[model samples]
Target: MTAARVGVVTFPGTLDDQDAARAVRLAGGEAVPLWHADHDLKGVDAVFLPGGFSYGDYLRCGAISRFAPLMDELIPAARAGLPVLGTCNGFQILCEAHLLPGALTRNASLHYVCRDQRVAVESASTAWTGDFTVGQEIVLPVKHGEGRYVASEETLDALEANGQIVFRYAGGNPNGAMRDIAGISNEAGNVVGLMPHPEHAVEDLVGAPSTDGRGFFTSILSKLVNA
Candidate 1:
């Protein structure tokens, strides 16, 4: 059978596109390279927005990248259940596109943070997290200056009630995100965005801190295979 094809998007300054693609490949899927300027999705099974300073971060995080030509096609596809995932700056773009809720602001410390972060899976029902179980803690790398997630109290409560909250900081709140939210899914659970870089932790041979991140790719591949 043909392997699941996952699209890894590259915006200008997108530093993690290759890493994300490698994770998909390692998870037994085919990684398809996508450019920000491309107007089509190339018929991939799922889409991944990798982390980086898109548009030089001239505007607030993903504000500019939100208008990328590719996003014009992506937004609707994601809404139609294409299964999309994002990390760090990719998470910011997902919010700007309104594909996911909440916004990532500057870390409370007012400094960039880079470290191995332990995140507990709060909801494994989403496409990208199905391999995990509730309360399972996985370590992934996080590197960002603006990583604090903020949303309205009502929104947070609703997310909690609907099981849309995906991951939460395990050891401690790394960025003062509301309710310690590290990641979340949309109402339908097809789209997900997180502050940590799962792509960075999928390989341990290169001295990566953990191989836990590989599950994100595998989870989505499983979903595609069964769909």
Candidate 2:
């Protein structure tokens, strides 16, 4: 059987495309490179937006990249039920594009934090989180200055009621995000965005504290294969 084709979108300043691609391959999927300036998806089964300072985070993290040519296609597809996963800077893009609710902001301490953080999976029903179980804890790398997530109280209540909150800071709230939110999914559960760098924690050989991040890639492959 052919491996699932997962497109890894690369914006001008994307820094984790290669790592994301490698994680896809390791999860038994083919990683297709997607250029931000292009109009094609190359028939990928799913899309991944990796971490980085897109457009050098000029106006704001993910602000400029939100209007990239590729997003023109991605936004509709995501709304039409194509599964999408965005991490770190990619998370910011998802918000800026209005694909997901809430926005990321500067850490309360006004500092960049890079660490192996523990997150508890609160909901594993989403396409990218299916390999996990509710309450499962995993360690993933998180590095960002503007990573705090903020949303209206009503939005937060609705997300919680709908089980759209996927992950929460387990050990500590590194960014002072509201309700310790580490990740969340859209109302349809197909699009997910998080502030962690899962691509960086997919392998043990790279000195990652845990290979737990591999589940994100594998889960998407399973979703595509089953569908």
Candidate 3:
């Protein structure tokens, strides 16, 4: 009856590692600190890549961090169904790592946006979103400059066919993401990436009074317990 152990990876320039770990703990899981340079996963049940400007956003948003030593282990583990969740810059890293398909590009408006966004859960079968119901709308904070999602038409069709599209902007497409996509999961539904910071919305005393983000952490813990 031990708590589920969730690893929160911290890449250089990562700004949300502590917040992500706090979310894990608030969800009743044990948060394991993981470094970008570490080659091992430390036996955690699942891994989370928090939002940040890794590698100082050099080259591209997540280009450099994708090759981090820890990613060497993470990539394989995620592919093998280890359950991975990436938010914001972490989402960019997931795409760069090819853990999830599609890519996050510069916002269509060419402006950095930071706000509480309403998104609908398009697919809840993913490990990180199982607690949510399909089409349920929730509010999460999004802060990023390159948050627009782009993919080929064929890829978009396939993602739709496979139910890989996880979340979509509810009211309007803030960043002009293709098809209003805000988040998506891999084919196996074990790995997910999103351009919003769910960790930032988990506490009521913080900026927003909504705790909608807590489900992301709890959902994974539930999946681990059931496994």
lDDT values for all models? 0.93, 0.94, 0.94
Q: Please rank every candidate by lDDT, starting with the best.
A: 2, 3, 1
Task: State the TM-score for model 3.
Answer: 0.98
Model 3, residue 188: C-alpha shift (Å): 0.4
Clashing pairs in 1: none
70: Cα error in model 1, Å: 0.4
Sequence-dependent TM-score of model 2 = 0.98
What is the alpha-carbon lDDT for the whole of candidate 2?
Answer: 0.94
What's the C-alpha lDDT at position 119 in model 2?
98
- Candidate 2 lDDT over residue span 117-181, tens digit each: 99999999999999999999999989999999999999999999999999999899999999999
Question: Candidate 1 on 82-173: residue-level lDDT in tens?
Answer: 99999999999999999998899999989899899999999999999989999899999889999999999999999999999999998988
For candidate 1, the lDDT comes to 0.93
Query: Where in model 3 is the C-alpha error above 4 Å?
Result: none
Candidate 1's displacement at residue 29, Å, is 0.4
Candidate 3 residue-wise lDDT, 83-191, digit = tens: 9999999999999999988899999999999888999999988899989999799999989999999999999999999999999998878899999999999999999
- Residue-level error in angstroms, candidate 3, position 148: 0.3
Candidate 1 segments whose C-alpha is farther than 4 A from its true place: none
Candidate 2 weakest ten by summed lDDT = 200-209
